[model samples]
Target: MNSSFGIKHIAQFILFVALQILLVDNLVLFGTGFCFIYVAFLLFLPIGISRMWLLILGFITGFTVDVFYDTIGIHAAASVLLAFLRPLVLNLLTPRDGYDTNDSVNIHVMGWRWFLAYALMLILLHHTAVFFLEKISLQDAWYTLAKILLSTLFTTTVMVILQLLFFSPKRERVDYR
Candidate 1:
């Protein structure tokens, strides 16, 4: 990657991780679904990025968050899993026309339906893995499952709202000669 692209991602990494640690982590929804908005950084990565890089980015992001959360490697594990599964999820949801190099995995570009499906699936997977790993017991299976579902729904909502507010679709200009 070029210097600028690298720099942009670095900035995003810092911005997301800080927000997760300092802000969203404390914004627990009814003392359950902690906002993991940091995952959006991985979700919003460029479509053309290599799988290896995806894994690396995911690990680094999760590891950074884990450092703050002091929860061993739960975040890292979930993030890596999400990164590994990302391509499979994209392949499963590939459009009939396929993807454009310039196409991003944002709501505007992928449409609300595709974006929701994609985000919800990943968010649920990540939350399930994280909560299960954190609890590490079936003693309260029902409660754990409820936490996973609630966290997934809350995190997914936050991701969608952030996309709607901050990120916009690129528009190509039309020229007539």
Candidate 2:
């Protein structure tokens, strides 16, 4: 990848983590929905990134959040699970023409339907792993399921808004000779 792409991703990683720690962490809704915006960073990573790097990045992102949340690596494990399943999800969602090397997982590039499906599935999986790992019991399966579903919806909505507000493609000017 180019230096600019690398820098952009690094900046995004820091931004998402900071947002999660500072803002989204305390922004729970209905006592069930928790927005894990940091997962967006992992979900939006370059489509062509290798599996090994993706796994490492996943661990790093989750571990960083784990450190601040003091949740003893729950975030790390969930993030890693998200990373491990990402490729399979992509393959399942692949377009007939396939993805361009430069394509990203944003709405502008992938359209609302594809992006929503992508975000929802991954976020659901991430939240499921997280809440289950935290609860570690089926005794409160109903509550845990509620938390997972609500959090997935909340996170997916925020990710879509963030993509629309900030990650929109910049238009280029063309001059006819």
lDDT of 1: 0.86
Relative to the true structure, candidate 2 reaches a TM of 0.94
Q: Please provide, for model 1 over 25-77, each residue's C-alpha lDDT reduced to its tens digit, 9 standing for 90 to 100.
A: 78887877677989999998877778999999999999999998899999999
Backbone clashes per model, in order? Answer: 0, 0
TM-score of candidate 1 to 2 decimals: 0.93
* Model 2 CA lDDT for position 18: 99
Model 2, range 126-158, lDDT digits (tens) per residue?
Answer: 999999999998999999999999999999999
lDDT of 2: 0.90
- List RMSD in Å for every model shown: 4.1, 4.3
Please report, in order, the local distance difference test score of every candidate based on alpha carbons. Answer: 0.86, 0.90
- Misplaced by over 4 Å in model 2 are 170-177
